[model samples]
Target chain A: MLRDFVKNIGYDDPLEICLSELEALLQYNYRISKRSAALLLLQEDPEMFELVRKNEAERAEKIFSIIEKIKPHYSYPLAYIISERRQREASRIAAAVTTVGKKGSLGIKEALSRAMMNPFIGGPILLAVMYYGLYKFVGNFGAGVVVDFLEDKVFDQHLNPVFIDVVNRFVPYPVLRDLIAGDYGILTLGFRYAFAIVLPIVATFFFAFAIIEDSGYLPRLAMLVDQIFKKIGLSGRAVIPLVLGLGCSTMATMVTRTLPTKRERIIATFLLALAIPCSAQMGVILALLESRPLGLIIWLSVIVGVFMIVGFLASKIMPGELPSFYMEIPPLRFPQPSNVLRKTWSRMKWYFLEVLPLFMLASVLIWVGKITGVFGFLVRLLEHPVRWIGLPSESAVAFLFGFFRRDYGAAGLYDLKTQGLLNGNQLVVACVTLTLFLPCIAQLLMNIKERGMRVGVAMSVFILFFSFGTGWLVYVALNLLGLNL
Target chain B: MVQYDKDDKKQVVPLSELKPGEKGQIAYLQAKGKNQMQKLLSIGVIPGMSVLLVQRFPSYVFKLGHTQFAVDKELASSIHVKPVK
Candidate 1:
């Protein structure tokens, strides 16, 4: 049956002649038939070419020569021509085997799917999803309520004091005690931040994202945004990584590998690093600006404006082929509870495993920096720029923390806000600057790993200056407008 | 309605020109690169297959067999089709 099937699916005359000629020359044993191997070689399958070269040795050159000879027969690539022929055969078989039925009228699901692709309707739908899914569920509940409860009630009330008391009694050295249980200790600061604050916010975000993905709404959202994305040198396929960036930019940076072009990956990476704040940072910012609506609006406007302008400028500066968009639009379906839970749990576990150690390491690094006076020096250096951006010099600590982890920095700002240190204008400027700040150390390493070192370091340098410059502009603009929040 | 040439019976136009609900048979792909051609072919967009334009706004969406796909205007324009009236 296999032999007959293989023979029946022969290509056009010129390709067939070349395939047979190449097949006759191939002496090596392969898992697939020589005909299929010959076809792959003709279509320029690099893996097959390598295998044939390794296995066939001297005969490989002859086989390649036959493949080269067949090239001028068609204007299109052999792969495309072969695929077109196969499709024609497949359609013929499909038409012969299947019976056609009368088309049915549009159902409620179909209408809803259409409405989702409609710009006017989809715009409101997207806003509603973000407002409910991100703002209310992740921000208010996860970051606000859950974080507060865990940090204040659980960790502070029960865990930290017990750990601190036990460490002080058992540990002999003051420095060791500080390292293990004091203010910037692994137990008190690192573990607390990871489990109490970042965990809940990230968990809620993953849960919400899982539901959105399972419902098959992302492709529709991508379709609606393709036109706008093209203006920034990205195709709608980039929406996946960009949305995932909201959950965790480090993970999103890795996801940029799915993009078709280097240019798209670089642009997406830049945007994720620069403008798209992770859920943890966003939740803290939302909480910080909750009281001052005008401050929140200004921060939002500034961040969004920076996102577009930077993306547009990057597209023009980077030279490459424009990204082309193509994606399957799966039917929208109700998300299954079990699937959502499983996805959310797996992502949370992956994130926690990747991040917890880094948080602990950050705590140790901060401790080292404090003892060595490096942290103080860096904070003093950051203070100049912080002051330059019209922020109080004290907020420099948060900017330093921003390098360790983007959310850690935002959480630092949250502490400042609680102490009533930042006024409305200052709060907005800080938020805007911090949101546009460099990606966390983890994402920076990922950027380097995924893109080459030169591009990654280049982007980081650009962001360092651009973020502060944008923040300074926002400060001047806000003051020039003379509108008090 | 089918479009016709003065010299021939069938007139070919880029698939992007088709309005929603119009039907066409793909004539050929004028893809500029091997990557684009591979992507289109992997999705089963090939000569002789019937295509139905489902939506043309924000992006171009079309149906091939039972599956639906969305492509940007650049990709859509590369697909030359003959209208099926």
Candidate 2:
């Protein structure tokens, strides 16, 4: 059977090659038929080789010699020769069996899609997408409108007081009451943050991102950013993780595994940590700066500027050949409402599930910290920097909350916002600092897991100092400019 | 009719519709480039080959058995086939 396969592949009939000497070759200790075993060997088929080696070791040696003689006849590897023969056979059949004609029209839609991938047309188009898909819709409408409805109407007026009453009545201890109903309470803060604050904002973000993804706009975004990305030593491919990091940096850190080179993955992980603000952070920042247009613009410029500058520096430090990039742009399909909804619903559910338990756990830790009076001590310790940044001492808690959950810290700022604690310049400074803050513990753990201890710890420490250092600089710059809210 | 049906399941297509990160098997390679297709062949993309679509964001990363290769989506769309079961 193996011998027959060889004859078929060698493109010759075995019967013609074998003659008077065939009987000797067939003997148990004789050469395993020359062309047949070599062809199977070229196919890298182990089973056939095992059978032939078992039945005729002596014969296999003789066949191996013939294969050695045949080897120099081709410049390429043997596997290439075998596959070229197979593809020729496949193409021949395809030619006979199928018909393709006049090709499909390369009409307006195709040309427009191509135009979108070019840097000149693509850059402004990307800004339009961010403005419409992200800023106006998700940031303003979802975080502003939807969150106001839930947090103000639903939680502030209805849910929180009721939970407060329940805890007050059921619990005898003042400490326990506060643990469940007081500041940083699981029900009052955690659940509220998840539902009232993060929910509407993320739901809208995922909806917008789904449209971009399903339309196959991501690859084009990659192409548009390729040159700028090259300065950071990554091809345009890093755009996927960077884009996704906006949704959740923790997941984006894990997705870094998909990058082609180790250098790209490290650069991506570092950038995600430094500049990309996840949805929760984005929602909070939007709320903070939405009232002050100048503040918002300044904050955006700083983050984007830092992302590029740091990326360029990392690219220079990291040594590797930049992998050439080629990505598929699926035809831009009109985003189906149902598919968009399903994707949004699923992604939101996944995000909520991953965060809910952690939020609950953070509440427990704070409860313990409060019980031990350690929470107060930590707040006092954080107050020096809070004051240094010109933030009110009370803002220390939000900075603490940031370490546990990056977005939760931002939500804490929302609490401060309602109290009118942050003026325009202060809001800008706070937003800048938080955007550069270390990723939440989840994303940090993922960074350590993916990039390992040395790379991971080193990155987090650099970011820790850099976040405060930059925050301090921004604070001074804003103050010196004498801009008042 | 096809669009209506695709609404229910994922918009799964034949190998010719392979995007980055999609997994499929090679049914055939139509048209030419028949000679230089050795890169695909050496990586085990001949007929009856199975591959996992790894990264579809920037390009297509297909892991054929063990070897990983990236190709532009256009080239991927050119390879016609039934998907892996």
Candidate 3:
């Protein structure tokens, strides 16, 4: 194979021949290739050293000594020198085998790639996408419309009452009825939250995300955000986790494994735990401020501001230089509708399965806590922080619930919003605090899985204090400004 | 760049597969590069970049030169070859 591409060897250096021989030696044993073997020889591969040594005891020993003698003269670790040559051969062949024409893909694709990468212009375009793709389409259309039909019209109004009656009549025991079909019933809160709240919003998000991912919009997004993210010591790779964080921070935490350094991972994980909120939280927030544009601006500004500021501070504290950012930008393809739909469906299925169990488990835990009075005890403990932030005592329950899952807290807030229990200022503080709260159990588990328990616990404590601290500041500032919703 | 490995252990293998505090030889590289060979020859990846799969996972960790990269499997596939050392 190396011979076929060998148009010319420039010079049959002894090292090259030795490597070729080495490759053959390895191949006789059913190995991959010899050229690769030879390259590894030049690189002075430690593993292959034993294999080569055993192949030709005296000569291999002699060659090893010579390699050691000559190794330092070359700046490249021998491995790179070999790979570079192969790459050259590949290039030479590619030049011979392929040709490019003046014409290529154009119109929308090229224009979109450019637009998505440019920061100044791209920022607003991003916001527009957020507004439509996220706020209007997902929040209003999916969660608001689809969810209402499934949760309220179909389940709550029509199905729940029927199920309740059937369970009550069939099950004579009150305690058993409560467990299966009553207030703490799995069929009620668990299924309702999963189907109604989480499903619709996630379905829409996956739809939008698939389109963006397939179109190659994500890398461009990384390019656009590189500067801002760089200030925080993350390169474009951080963008993947950060962007995915919007969909599900737990998943994003796992994806952070793609980043380059322990330092960067720590920083990314910290920022994620503290700042990035998932799709459901984003949607609920948007809906909370949907009728109030100014309020939305304040919320966005605050979150972004905190993101930048905290990121800056963390990068400074962590010991490592910013990694150079480079990512393979796959050619932008028109996002196929079917691909988008399939991706959305698959992700929704994953999200639903993951969340449904957690929701049911959470309901059971809550039920037990309620029965045991532990729920009130925990809520009371949470209320002190709630009061410190100037939110109503009821908001403590949401904060307490936030520990179970971040979105669950948002759902609790949504229930409160219906009762008009919060104002613009209070809402802003609540949103900021909840958004910055320690990541849910899943993300915490991911943090432990990826970064280990020490970093995970440290991150959790940092987030808890930081979130409440931020909330306290926001609450004080709002009051100082005398702006009341 | 070198051609991708045709073997079973595709570049998609997690970086955690690499041993800690160990080095591997660059057996090959396959990328669509013309000057890439020259560039690699210059850098020494020409079958001898001293391919060290450093600090795997938490970042596709690699340490070379005065630099380090958290390389993903996507990048690894572009530069093929068996680990020799």
True-structure RMSD, every candidate:
2.7, 11.4, 10.7
Residue-level lDDT tens digits of model 3 in B1-85: 3344456345333233566555654555454443333333443344534455643332344544323333433344454445555
Q: After superposition, how far is residue A337 of candidate 1 from its true place, in Å?
A: 1.6
TM-score of candidate 3 restricted to chain B? 0.48
The estimated TM-scores of all candidates read: 0.95, 0.75, 0.78
* Model 3 global lDDT (CA atoms, 0 to 1): 0.72
Give the Cα-based TM-score of candidate 2 against the true structure: 0.75
Worst 10 residues of 3 chain A by lDDT: A21-30
TM-score of chain A, every prediction, order shown: 0.95, 0.85, 0.89
Q: TM-score of model 1 relative to the true fold?
A: 0.95
The clash numbers for all candidates, in the given order, read 0, 7, 39
What docking class should model 2 receive? Answer: incorrect
Task: Arrange candidates by TM-score, descending.
Answer: 1, 3, 2
Total clashes, candidate 1? 0
User: What is the DockQ for all candidates, taken in turn?
Assistant: 0.58, 0.10, 0.08
> Which candidate tops lDDT?
1
